[model samples]
Target: MATICISTVLNFRLRKPRGFCCSLSSHDKMKNNNKRETPELLKIAVSGITELLRIFSSSKDQRLDTVTYTQKDQPLVSGIEDIVDILQSDYENAYFLTGNFTSSIYAEDCSFEDPTIKFRGKDLYARNLKLLVPFFDCPSLSLQQIQKVVSSDKSCVLATWKLRTYLKLPWRPLISIEGNTVYDLDDDFKIARHAESWNVSALEAVGQIFTPGT
Candidate 1:
């Protein structure tokens, strides 16, 4: 298990940005308020990886009850080209930041792994993304390259991306990470595994959380 030092960081809170517009209607404002209850939510958000690891282990059997879609609504693709298109579109729209990617493209038990943690089940993966949404301020993911590759009998979709996000810590640390993800497809073309390789070490990535923003 990887350990991160965050004892001093958890007391942080998120404040609305200066000159940020809030023009939501009454109903919309109520809904947004219901979605996030502050202070408590802030506590959960800033604990960061420790909280994520706990949730990853504890949520193994939980289903993604947040999403509902019938067969007609599923973005089921028959080939790598279609898969690539959907993925690119999702990244373009920053769906990954919002935890609303097209889940139909991934296997029900698809495995997800990065330098910090690893887990099985796409439902769990989605839940993890949803958990991190509270701390992702002005997040951006730039897709540099995406292509299909085959090596002997195995094939996968590899995508390189640059990610920059201002974590809602007290000092507002800016995390900039460049990484590539390998999506291994199953027989039916659904993603069986999603593995990420970062340009920095696990320690370095964690250290970014403590570095104060400029």
Candidate 2:
């Protein structure tokens, strides 16, 4: 007499409670979905950046590509074109986080709590953060590479910005190209006065924040 195990039969359903089918492997899933690679704009950008930032050591006369901002003695992303794009581009429903805000800004070191970061800002706060990214721009040795200030790190300024409109008359808003909230480019000054909450304490904490436009 052959007996089928009831537990085994029931467990099959448990494996896929959603019934969405998990049998397909990650690679297989992409393949089945007909995933194809888009033109790698990053590589092209890297090459052009490398050309722009051929020299390093940080000097007023030095031909640098990237620039940095030091408001309270902290290293901020400031403005690396590619990096800006990186921060602006939308991710696959992701999260961008770091253990220490100090380290994240200064060291370029980050520990993304979420596997991916959808830079697209669905919230006002997120939009403001995107504007802040440019404030960190510094002269790069090569494209995204950081260029030390000839001697001391005092080449850029650290300022604050706002995501929404606040001007009494009219506020020129930046529209994200990809329809993502993160990539907004304003023709007029992007900084919103009241919306900005920058303070000496915040600047001091960040250390070496910059206010270039200031």
Candidate 3:
């Protein structure tokens, strides 16, 4: 698991510059946001492992994208260390390519469609995890949920740490070594953070977002 995870993360950099842009947008939101003179409904990118595995295999071992946390900047968060323990212990799952289900990973010309997965060992739930990532300019965002959020909204982007509130979201952390330390928040007034983010960039490099596109 450790070798696989490391190889996977390092492979996100092998893409040609054009590879980073999503098929849905003309360019990354930073560059293309200006060309469109009118407001458009945002088509958000949700994380999925299938694509990350592909991307990592193709990306020649470069460090995967870094996401600055909102909690690193906030002084109010307390008792957060236990958050890591909860995640590492309670969450456990594995990612595998869905045979030939790769064509539908990204939606067709106009929709934000995501793939479908079958997990029955535990109940699954969905929610929106609002993140203050440096790479993004949007105020709110979403992550495809793999757990039940009986107490949270679909609007909140997830963070490893808690902000004003957190839904006790479930996380299936990757197995790893060398560093199990959770990232500390940056100095940028970090408010909230995701308790878990499955690293899936490697899967994307090879166009394995989701073959079936369900």
Candidate 4:
């Protein structure tokens, strides 16, 4: 992100009557005033703006990059190997997640629900992920189990996983949560609905926060 600086200065001097102004000094004062004020005003305005922008830009960058987590080197689970691979690769990369997986793996009218929120449609899901980007850094999801069940015309996958993350908060830097997702797949194997269940509740998550690596 870049910050734009705009500095403007306007100086106006009202003309005085010749009788009120000193005759000997009036001409010299006028000449010197124009020469001095213009450059000084510009310099003052420009420097002030530059310094303010420098401070603002640095602060903004720090806030955006504050949250940092470690990626766990865990192997994928067995059953849904292909989806697990995609999760490890594309979904893990925060930058690529919204663009790649949301459109391909999920149906447009997909319903998603977790402990915190429930929403329908891929656009809302993408928006929720975008909101998380600033607060999530280097987050990793490890797959523990994957089971596939097929009925007459429909199929579903149950995936159990653990998410380990470092939340860049002064009070709680480390957070670990275990959860499972059940995916209802359409005839083409695209995800029609996704739901999640976590071992911890929202208040429990707040209580479980600890220091990183502890």
The worst-scoring run of ten residues by lDDT in candidate 1 lies at 11-20
- lDDT (0 to 1) per candidate: 0.59, 0.20, 0.21, 0.45
For each candidate in turn, the TM-score is 0.69, 0.19, 0.20, 0.52
For candidate 4, write residues 1-214 as lDDT tens digits: 1111112000000111111111222134333332322234443554455445445644656542232223444433333445545444543553221233435666779876433333477765554343344443355666676666666656666655666655444543555666555667776666777765455433344344433334
Off by over 4 Å in 1: 1-72
Per residue, candidate 1 scores C-alpha lDDT tens digits across 105-157 of 98999976543344588876666565556667788888988877655555677
Query: Which candidate, 1 or 4, would have the higher lDDT against the true structure?
Result: 1
Off by over 4 Å in 3: 1-78, 93-191, 195-206, 210-214
> Using alpha carbons, what is the TM-score of model 4?
0.52
The candidate that wins on lDDT is 1
lDDT of 2 by residue, 37-150 (tens): 222452244233322322221233332223322123333443534333333221211111110122122222111110111112123222222222222222111111111111
Give the clash count for each candidate. Answer: 0, 33, 45, 0
lDDT of 3: 0.21
Model 1 TM-score, 2 decimals: 0.69
Error of 4 at 30 (Å): 84
Candidate 3 lDDT over residue span 1-214, tens digit each: 2323322222211111212111222123323322322112111111344244435533643323331122222223233343333322222211111011111111122111111221111101110111111111111212222211212222111222111111111222222211011122222312122222222222332232122221
Worst 10 residues of 3 by lDDT: 121-130
List candidate 4 stretches off by more than 4 Å. Answer: 1-102, 209-214
Q: Rank the candidates by TM-score, best first.
A: 1, 4, 3, 2
Question: Which of the predicted structures, 1 or 3, would earn the higher TM-score when compared with the native?
Answer: 1
